[model samples]
Target: MNEHILLVNPWIYDFTAYDLWMKPLGLLYLASHLKNSGYKVTLLDCMDRHYPFMPLPDHPGPKRLKSVGCGSYYREKIPKPAQFLSIPRYWSRFGIPWDEVKKQLKEIEPPGWVFITGTMTYWYPGQVAFLNLVRQLWGKTQVIIGGWYPTLCSEHAHQWGFDRIIEGIDPLLVIKQLSSDFKELSTITGYKEFFSVKPAFDLYKKLDYTVVLTSIGCPFRCTYCASGRYFSEFWRRPWEQVLDEITYDYENYRIQDLAFYDDALLYRAEESFLPLLKALQKERLPLRFHLPNSIHARYVTREIAELMRECNFETLRISLEFSDVDSQKNTGNKVDNFIFEKAIQSFIQAGYAPEELEVYLLFGLPGLKAKDYELSIEYVTDLGLKPRLSLFSPLPGTPDFEKVIMHQIKDDPLFQNKIAYLYLSEQNELYEALQRKISKYTFFH
Candidate 1:
């Protein structure tokens, strides 16, 4: 008999979060593999808005969905976590309520094994809550947790009582380990190659959007980023496979929003992105696409911009690490002012408005000056693009990790605060002052 496996996509607990076409691509891929291996796969998405037990809002209407398949979640105010009580923001659970999750688990009658996915280190509370509920219901069942948070903080996850925590993108070794212990589990074959399996979007009651990864890993090794360490190799799916997945999501699931989760979507445009875009254009499906992950500036040529415009890319973000040339090289000379300017011009010529173009500015980094980011914000705004400030969080393995150690900032008690602004060590106080000065342009406003 095929053993049953349950995949759980847990709720997001945060001060604020939006569905920017985000989906657990890793977990979904695992689910597809398990199904192909003859396991009865059941997915419990706690983020489902159409969950039967969800409370009816005071207002009556189909939920307000933005054109790009990006919008709000069903949120309910919850008490702040004990450690985060000092923060003034009202923390809420962003998904179907806890009662609904419990109801769904009971209805599913549990499974042979439970797998949970997580992202962002601070978002661990949601994963922990889901795991606790799972433990209460099926004490004997094995629980495995993986994803960004676990990959970054495995020790913390082990301390939380997760039966096993797998780090890194490859799951073959972990599967082998599990099989050794379970003895009766089916073997997963041909795991080394990048497998093409449609995400289990059908498992959700209502699919608002789906995330697709046409490629994995980035070629550049930016000093502060964990991309190189996480992936270790640059691999891309064939254009046909990527397009087929897109078509499958659109035709079968009626999904209108598709987000690409690739770190380097436009690495080699002529060979990779262009062919994919042309394929999408040829299909001419009424679909809205998004690139939440930043795109390489040098790759955004006039033709590419026009292609993107034709494909109905509703939201796009380009990475502009710093305005200063010195800082640019320090970060990763991915692109310079000339490339950025040309890219913005091409995007504008292709029909994107100033407000639609977002340039991500890395706000805090060890040894960085407050004026550095302020100048970057000014530079991006002067170019008629929206400046999106991304707070810096130090990961375990990166060139910047040595910098953090040298500066002794990573050991600080408050280093984990995503908004704490610890990266400006040289001008710490000045950084806070500068942040207040730039508060007007913040996304919340």
Candidate 2:
């Protein structure tokens, strides 16, 4: 098919991958804006779980038990890059294979422009492979890359020879940047004009779940987080318009599960978030909401917790990164023990069982010890909630990035791998042992 623009969500190459209601909301939103602007846009999402030819007879895996848009991608084992060869975990390409991708691409005529989304910094190898293929098929096309990877590692992304590298989270910048090349966005001033329009999710033949952004940027400046770098200040989308988008997806698309990809969904409970929740509760919809992004523990008030339960917020992951006093204070003092326990109690009182909740406790942070992880895990499990052990990856622009930059992997984005960062070079076997021990301990409890 011919189109004015093409949006591609590249495959993910990692030690492991899972689909937890994943979709390229950024590209989809751009598709909506471009289409409304009188351009035909098509999406080539390699990670799409609902592909027509997926789940082949005796497939590698039969789309591993999708539960409300959460499941596994059709992954095949691919060779790991040389840098990651030290890490003994099996590397896989987590998406549709290239032959199927070729079949899809063969149908489409070369477009006027191609906008590709970049995710994790380490996942660029997947983009690299896909980029090579796109270049070979449609040489010299305008292929602009954007999203977290290009934003965080622009210098590295520039090496790949993209026509343009769009940085930052301002959706206005999308049209603004494209205008520089194609001479179209001079009439557009800000993102407000498109704020009311829903993302082009209707472009999909099937959408199991949808993701929404109620706010841009974050209010807190956590040292390990890059939110402040992505957006200089916190800005809330007009809650009414946001509510309209959510309900439109619910009613029109027949979508029942919605995920909020906001950096801070509850910065100030009295303002946008609370009102949005109240409006949603009033709708009496059976939609299940999820906050996979860590909700600030500081903002969880009794009323907020109660409203969350009322609105059917299914997945509640708290951002209680550190377990101790000083470390907790280091995390922008977002949540202290009293506040953390209070939030849990508030949710419990609001009809949530502790195990139904998940608490994120960071492991392998600079000063943390294995005992610290053990205590942190015990702390969450003791509260009757599950503990999510997140390995620390030093994202560029975060304060911690400097500490890791001194190492050799600084030249390679693969060094920033979240799961295998603890197992780099000479330290591999040691941390590998530690990972095994931690997994064993976790399974034990």
Separate clash counts for every candidate: 0, 0
lDDT of 1 by residue, 70-137 (tens): 55677888986565555557778888888877877898856878988877766777888888998899
TM-score of 1: 0.87
TM for candidate 2 is 0.92
Q: Provide TM-scores for the models.
A: 0.87, 0.92
**Weakest lDDT window of 10 consecutive positions for candidate 2:** 56-65
Task: Give candidate 2 regions above 4 Å deviation.
Answer: 1-3, 56-65, 425-445
Worst 10 residues of 1 by lDDT: 406-415
Off by more than 4 A, model 1 = 56-65, 171-194, 401-417, 420-445
Best by TM-score: 2
Backbone clash pairs in model 1 (N, Cα, C under 3 Å; residues 3+ apart or in different chains), count: 0
Find the candidate with the highest lDDT and give its number.
2
Q: lDDT values of the candidates?
A: 0.74, 0.77
